[model samples]
Target: MADIVEVRNKQVIFKDYINGYATGSDMVVTSDATIRLELPKNDDSLILTKNIYLSCDPYMRNRMNRTMEGNYIDSFTPGSPIVGYGVSRVLESSHPKFKKGDLIWGLVGWEEYSLIKDTRTFIKIQVTDVPLSCYTGILGMTGLTAYVGFHEICSPKKGETVFVSSASGAVGQIVGQLAKLFGCYVVGSAGSKAKVDLLKNKFGFDDAFNYKEEQDLNAALKRYFPNGIDMYFDNVGGKMLDEVLRNMRVHGRIAACGMISQYNLDKPQGNYNLLMLIMKRIRMEGFLVFDYYHSYPKFLEMILPLIHEGKITYVEDIVIGLENAPAALIGLFNGTNVGKQVVAITNE
Candidate 1:
């Protein structure tokens, strides 16, 4: 057994339940917390981890609300550290499946070190050739999200016309690439010109537009997909969704991955195009990635090769320290990060 080691642990704590959008002030980052780098005596189920990288996801915004409605996860406690997907190096472990020095990714606290009791959410890292940070986004939850949401939920067909909202984001970028690989004609929308360029030039989307510049989203969709959209991978909901519904082809499929547009609002804007679903015979479905985690091995098998062979590309907007996590997370809502936002607590 390794000697018990105690160290100062820096943590990003959730200050309180919030209303509307979140800001850096809603969280407190401090190094006052400390932890013993060992599992509690005789506890065979607990795992001690040194968090290496933490993921900043837009869905975390809803979890900060005082009252979580229809959310799969619970709201963060007022005085505790925020928890999210992260990659960590195991320092000590009592669980039969893990051991000291093993790397894993799943739900972890926003801290330098986390004592993980729940192993159900954790998955051991088998491949180390890629950047470990990839586990926080591409090789982890967001990658799986793009795969399942597009391939399974969207039920995409080759040569079909597809549109992805927030196409420059972690999930959206991958979704667009997957659609293209599946022999579909893809168009994407992002918030900035650089992101739009990235979609067309980097990810090989057929076309991309800056959504913020479009006065009428309906017109933009019409210009891109004159034949009407066959599949819609929706990340930004609200207005975009309503417009897309009007432009969808008959028998179209919509995968409702997220509603980032409505997260900060007190009352979510309603989509007024419910009638379009009926008129077009659309199949729109909302999915939580947790439900499809059972197929993670299959997802990795498909994604890893594409990544290595250069068929797929992933970009990350990584911040260097835990102290900067609040700003990194807050930036997700304001369109600040250009790609997957990750906070690197330490290099392993």
Candidate 2:
């Protein structure tokens, strides 16, 4: 057996409830938390894990505020380590489903080490040749989110025009490519010119525009979708949504994945054209990835081959260390990352 080792566990601690936009100051990186290497034998379900990668996602911004709606996810407690989806390797385990050296991806603390008492939400790494870092993005929750939102919520049809906002993002990138693979006409709107170019050239988006450059969003949509948008994969809400609603065709289906634009707002943005929902008879539905985890195997069954066969590609902007996690996380709101933002906690 490996000898027990005691070590300092570095953590990113939540400072307080947020008001407007969150900055790196909202989370503090500290090395004060410490843990023993030995796994506790009292509980059969306990798993001791060494975190390898941490995910920095837009939805995490929702948890920074104390006033969020109940039952979705809890607000991060002040002075406690911020928690999110992470890829980890089992250091030790008393759980039947896991053993030492087993790699899994699920919700875990933003720390070097963790004592995970619950294993139900975790999915073991079944395929290793694919980059393990992908577990934090394409191969993990982010991929599942893209899969469920596009295929499950939107129910896309071939030759249909599909519009995706935040189209260069982790989920949005996959959604656009999946739409193309389904024989849909895909157009995407991203925050920057580089991302817009990525959407058009790399992800195979039929057309893409930098939303920041467009003086009139509705006009841009009309220019891109002259016939009208048949399906809209909305990653940004607020004004973008309002404009898309005006340009949607009758019976268009909208999958509400994330509203990154509204995450940091003190007051959420309201839509003036929501009456278009009734006028066009569009179906706008919101979904949570947790509700669709049962389809993860199904997601892999489809995505893995595409990845290996080079039919699908993914990008990740990785920060090297846990200490830089706060800045990396805050960068999501600022559009600093061109693709999926992942923090490498360990070189392994």
In angstroms, the error of model 1 at 313 is: 0.5
- Clashes (candidate 1): 0
Q: Candidate 1, residues 197-313: lDDT per residue as tens digits? A: 999999999999999999999999999999999999999999999999999999999999999999999998998998999999999999989999998999999999999999998
TM-score of 2: 0.98
**Per-prediction TM-score, please?**
0.98, 0.98
lDDT of 1: 0.94
lDDT of 2 by residue, 42-142 (tens): 78999999999999999999889886776398889999999999999999899999999999999999999999987888989999999899999999999
The alpha-carbon deviation from the true structure for residue 14 of candidate 1, after best TM-score superposition, in angstroms, is 0.2
